[model samples]
Target chain A: MNGTPEGTPERTVRVVIVDDHAIFRSGLKADLDARIDVVGEAGTVDQAIAVIAEARPEVVLLDVHLPGGLGGGGREVISGSATLLGSTSFLALSVSDAAEDVVAVIRAGARGYVTKTISGAEISDAVMRVADGDAVFSPRLAGFVLDAFGTAPADIADDELDRLSARELEVMRLIARGYSYKEVAKELFISIKTVETHVSAVLRKLQLSSRHELTKWAAERRLL
Target chain B: MTTALQRPPLVRSSDRMIAGVCAGLADHLGWPVKYVRLGMVLASFAGGAGVAFYAWLWTMVPTADESARRNARRPASPIAPAVSLPAPVVREAPRGPLPLGPLPDGGAPPFAVPAPAVAAWFRTRRIQYGKEILLGAGLLLVAAILIARQFGVDVPLGTLIPAAAILGGAAIAWMQLDETRRAGLVDKTKADQAGGWVRLAAGLALVVAGVLVMVSGSGSWEQTWLALLASVAVLGGVALVLLPWGLKFWKDLETERAGRVRETERAEIAAHLHDSVLQTLALIQRRAGSEQDVVRLARAQERELRIWLYRDAAKDAGLLADRIKAAAAEVEDTHGHAVDVVTVGDAAMTERHEALVQAAREAMLNAARHGGGTVSVYLESSDAGSEIFIKDRGPGFDPDAVPEDRLGVRESIIGRMKRHGGTAVIASSPDGTEVRLGLKAADTAEARIGEEKP
Candidate 1:
């Protein structure tokens, strides 16, 4: 839950908060726990990508609307950092709960989505979840994702779900349904390392940045 | 005579209705004011020709005091006593049916028409009257010859008739020319019922004469049909002259009516806004501590304004649901509660729809206040009706336990639905509480009837 494996020391979760508003960034930095290190901050899509790549933070709190760089907003920041996707996971912290915004960022590889009205503690928890490879969304945003990616998988022939091997699909469904990696490995009679490999492959094939987005993607399509 | 001719006409403001145009015309033409006004009213009924002429004359004439001021401003030339005086003296002249005294000095009113312009006008009038007289004499001679033939009198009709017609036409032409030439030197007097009255009476007489001609011609129908036809044609020509004025008046009246209707509608909207939205805004201003309360008031005002501006757009179910979700989001943010809004199917956005959303919002607020955990909202709509359910997973209370002063439930939720002819049913137990608000399509009929009552 704290982004550390069992038997390991409690390590700080390195985070980079990306938002256009300076006051919000400062307030959020002030509010978070000392255990969570604030590595860098960025006000635009290009700055976000550059800062995330340079800092190599474990979690990036990205806003949906940014000033510059491709004009694709948070989606651009996420897609622009394809090389850093394996290491740095993104949790969208935006003021918009618009369905299109939530779905677009998720489809472009953000780990989760939350509105700006969320309490500092809730945002900190979401950051830890994204760092620990879990999909976290504000309550209503999950419905938006679910509605965007229709419930029935019958219309998902060209969907990322169709590209995964059956074994990977099995691991995806269990993980998306909130099972830990060890639990998923145990369910499938595979070693933890093999499960991790399959998860990474599924993430790559689906263009997902982390296990969190993989879960959200699978959950939205109701694969769970 | 020269002094009398120098005086200008005045637009008699005392005896006037709607601009003094008729009175002005009467004073300028040396006619009795009452007869001129009556003639204008009759002409208005006959396609409004008199109204047009009166409006023209109104602009052309000067008011009594205005002419007097102008005369005083000018240097006094050597003129007789009457012309230099103001209009009150002229108005005091004897109110006879005929224009009294030497044609009022036989010159045009200086303000109404310049001396050179009057001379030209008289010249044209003389030519027109001469032609009319010549035509009249020709028609008379023709009629005389026809009557003779009808009476079986075989007199030498051709030479006698042609000679008499020429001589009479020449004599009439000579008299009109001489009068017009004299009118240039002096103010030409007008009869009591000149201008508009003469035109109106002429039109009426022509119509009556046509009817008589038709009735008399019925006996020797074939032989005398031309006279009847000529009279009818003249009546039609007169009617054509009045048609444009009547059409113009009709158009003006229609535009005025439309403008009045628009004004009334605007006033109604202003009153409604003042009564409801403005009052709520004022109350919110007084109680400005809570941001949530302010937000709620602002959202209510926004919804009202949007409905007023884009009523058609507000009627779309999708847009309505979006608005409700937006309101729910604001509540969740302000209260720090998790609200899950799930909508199934579409319902038209009516006043009933608005009522249901408001009731649902109140229910959410109640649950957030009295209960715990996530607040869940479920909206199910079908052709029959729409049902909204707000649920909270927490300890519940009895409805009767609510205090008498708590009007949130009594007015905002339950009363709202009842007003819209819908139902709000709340069920609660120790584990959880759910407020079910149902609005049937049939209830819209009742709501409409309620609207009609006020």
Candidate 2:
């Protein structure tokens, strides 16, 4: 009991699926049924906001593109349901590997992102981690973050908040190489908790650096 | 999706001499406004049928602004109903718009005025050489008729009116059919303009001579009415015979346009498939574990699909980034390991750029063959030059451990870069090997502008 809590004592995590494809949502629900309780589902921005508000699931798997609402896609769903952010978490699930799309949802306050190609087990794992207040960074997202924060071997960054410490970059690189958190800890000769801390630090930089390069990236892509 | 857009609606034009009916008809039929106005005046002198037709058209057609508003309000594409989010919506097959009934000539106008202002003025005043000559001729004809009447040779107005109506109607119908036939023929500039004027003059002369003959050899009112009704029935029979052929022609044009649109839609679908399915396959290859054959098959399929989808771009694959990808794809095929290429910007291919690509290729081959894990190739090209990093995650080997003859890392990668006036840095530790290849541009001014603290 005194040890660190492991994800709310193994209770099944409640989740909502938000995708335009009904077949994909049903398939994903069947795959995650053992660990994840499918509380509700929605297909568009308005429906996603309504369903998430009503169910208040622990985690919501959101598609990056959806019809309805000012054409903002998943980012609109997140912002439209801002009040639920304190209780529920959002994880962007998309087929798009576009950097602007990934960064836009993250900036709009998604806990993490995972591509649709991820195995059901991996996605369930990501959902559980997000439910436990941990940020999930897929390999592609890590690469995008590295590129945005300028991996040019410069310690002093142009923007103060956008700077990644030497240790954070190492953690990000290992993650980008498809290392699990446990594997990253072993590779870096650090504890699993320390690996989490470094990843969290990188994530903070990713969110904070929004005003600098990431915002410019989204603007140049006409995402704004 | 409507013939409303294809066939310009018979709206009253903004350019007006009186009611703008003639101007709008001129625009719709692709004819000169002055000629259309003259035809309307001649028809009016015959029986006032022109006034009646103009009123019917003005009441029937919508204005341009109303049509624009209606089009704007039409929903572009139907949005899937959200009530059935748990089940996919079944959509009905799209129906093609039907071709409408034939109207005036579809040919482009011959005398396309170069400027709008000048064209408007010409339409209203028509103060050119032809107008003056027509006015003088009209005055001479009136004087001759008046002198004849004074000499006791009366012109029969009653028979003349009926004959003029029939002749004028026939002339307009013939001119419309002639214009349609001419539209199907080859387009000629100077010849078409001259021929158009000649045809108009001939048609008018024929109508006027026929009316005069009917007046001089006057017939009773009942016989004139019977002849008009007979001509109408004959023209109706002719139209019924040609209706099917005209419908077939328009249908062919619509099918061709629809086919072009379908082709573009197909290209978009292919791009979408590449983004989703190809990416999914790449991810599967990364985690396929014991199913090496499955992973290799998926990788090969993905490579083929990507190349096929971007075949047009591959024709001019001279960018440094494209060359690196071609090399990475080669390594992936031969060594059965995945190579993920992420490029920032592209530069034109140069001889030194070829060295970079070759060195990068050697580094990738070493990583795939020896490293035994997925290789990551990152290329960044700026104004100054290009920088490529080929990194792998397998257990690294010391450079000194390799024998003299097996000098792929030292000779093929590092040596190749050195000979090409570029620098290659090999950093191998217990974690992995990272080969950084940098090629500086020869332009000093650009290099200075792109200078940054290394």
Candidate 3:
């Protein structure tokens, strides 16, 4: 979005698509090939695999739980081909992001995963993310990953928090670590009243009753 | 402590070692610990039956100390926390004088649950899923290769690689009928055993069908006795077997989830022991540590593990809230959150239905994520009807969000939903978002309920 214009003529994103529905594949390819970057397309995993292995496209766009059947050999193709997921990069374009399908493909190490109903730009962006070595996952998938991982009750608001001034949290940590007002003031080269004010505000916001309890809660939350 | 109060028996654990209730009695009375143990073991041996007594003691007595709650976050002592590794335990310095409960009168409890059990389950799940995908893909590849050759599209794998590819795709898809065994992975409330039986039955049928097709070479199994035999034993037994045994995997998940249940979380102490101090102890046990050190460390870990488990118990009490969320989604058009409201009656289950469900879910998710809207859905209550609506308030652009991105108003909203006898409505406003779904439901009451509910 920065250097690239809205239609910046950069290297076209090469893509190989697969779907069991031939007409569906044709329609999809027409959309992609029309964009000046679609290298090849196939209607089944085999054709996609062969095309991907041969053409080595920048992105191997996939459709989950394809129209065809699945079992031992079908699973093997997905897993074996999974090696290319993080490298040559496989992007799942699926209709179902059911926890089973989403988690299954993710554990196999897909570079990017989105449903087929996604917009062309999102699909294009997924391809770009895969091309750029960044992992891409739909929003629903983000929750799936967190659920599957069973993340301990930790703050998952990292991106939002990153934008805020770290200085504020740091000041709160110093107070929680038992540095009294004057001491905190001395450490930060600020007035004792400023330290007192900050401590007062921190306690109020975190909703702790006293300084002692504040430190305890902060310690347990690893906020200190 | 008096003998009666001191000598509570061990709860159900393993055999061989008693809860040492007798030992507690001896220690309290300033007598040899072995005397009490021998008396009980002998008591059982004489007539009560030693093993039965052992089991009973395991059931009756607080294994370590019924009151000595191990922390759910860690192991018994400061001993090995991780399970795979062996680390020595160490006696921890007491925090302060305390009454009993999580705190020990003499010392913290000295027990730890093995760790590998929990981690290994997820790891096993991952491996199994990989196996399934690899198998599925391989089948497709072989078929696609055969089809290519059959159609003379090239790739000389012999006759009909092209036709075989098409059939293989069918065979591969037909094979997925077995993976249905994985449905309850996220939901614990489902009566899984019954489902497991059904899944096993279904899987076996699928496997038999697959094998019959592979080996029987296009024979009508209904007309042939050999096909029937193969279907029942080879295909049915094998596919059915994975479901029953795979049931352990399901139970393990339940055990993990129980940490969130009040009744079940009484056992969360075990997992806490595993995750924290147990994990730490496992690390310490292998390294050189004195017996006294291991004992002390184990005591510390037990307390820590106890604190963690109690805290986890508190947190797990609300785990039902998640299921509540899932249920709510079923009635509403929630995109970011999960909700599925579908009427799956045999003949009605068609490719179009699947495509519609998939498309709606995808678009709704996108609108919620990018278009900046709250996803709300209502399945129209009519004959086999469903109505879904997704609305967003983001800058309602004239053009679609993306081209290859697919879930545009076309493929995602109209095309797929339309196939399922459903309609997808995408309407965005400057104020906010909304999508209305009109779907055919066998029981309009179900769809009407979604609409009428708050």
Best-fitting candidate, scored by lDDT: 2
**Best candidate, TM-score-wise?**
2
lDDT of 1 by residue, B1-454 (tens): 3434544344446566877766665655566879867876765454444443354345334456545544575543221121223132223321112121101111112322334643553574454334333433444345455557679989764344334434443444454555456445234457412543454454444445434544454435654466657767987898899899989998998899889889999999999889778898897988799876775666456545644543443234454566566667766756756665665446668878888888988998888777786677766566678777787867997876877788988889889999998899887777567788988887657877999998
Q: Is candidate 1 or candidate 2 better by TM-score?
A: 2
- Give the least accurate 10-residue stretch of model 2 chain A, judged by summed lDDT: A1-10
Candidate DockQ values, in order, are 0.04, 0.05, 0.01
Writing each residue's lDDT as its tens digit, candidate 3 over B384-405 gives 4333334443565433554656
In candidate 2, position B213 carries an lDDT of 44
Q: How well is candidate 3 docked (DockQ)?
A: 0.01
- TM-score of model 3 vs. true structure: 0.28
Off by over 4 Å in 2: A1-14, A20-47, A67-72, A118-129, A132-134, A146-216, A219-224, B1-294, B300-317, B383-385, B421-434, B438-454
Give the TM-scores of the predictions, in the order they appear: 0.40, 0.50, 0.28
Task: List the lowest-lDDT window of 10 residues for candidate 1 chain B.
Answer: B99-108
CA lDDT, candidate 1, residue A57: 94
Candidate 2 vs 3: which has more lDDT = 2
Compute the lDDT of residue B367 as modeled in candidate 2: 92
Q: What is the TM-score of chain B alone in each candidate?
A: 0.30, 0.40, 0.24
Per-residue error (Å), model 2, residue A164: 6.6
Report each candidate's C-alpha RMSD, comma-separated, in the order given.
Answer: 21.5, 20.0, 34.6
- For model 3, fnat equals 0.00
Q: Give the residue spans of candidate 1 off by over 4 A.
A: A1-11, A146-224, B1-345, B350-362, B372-387, B391-395, B398-454
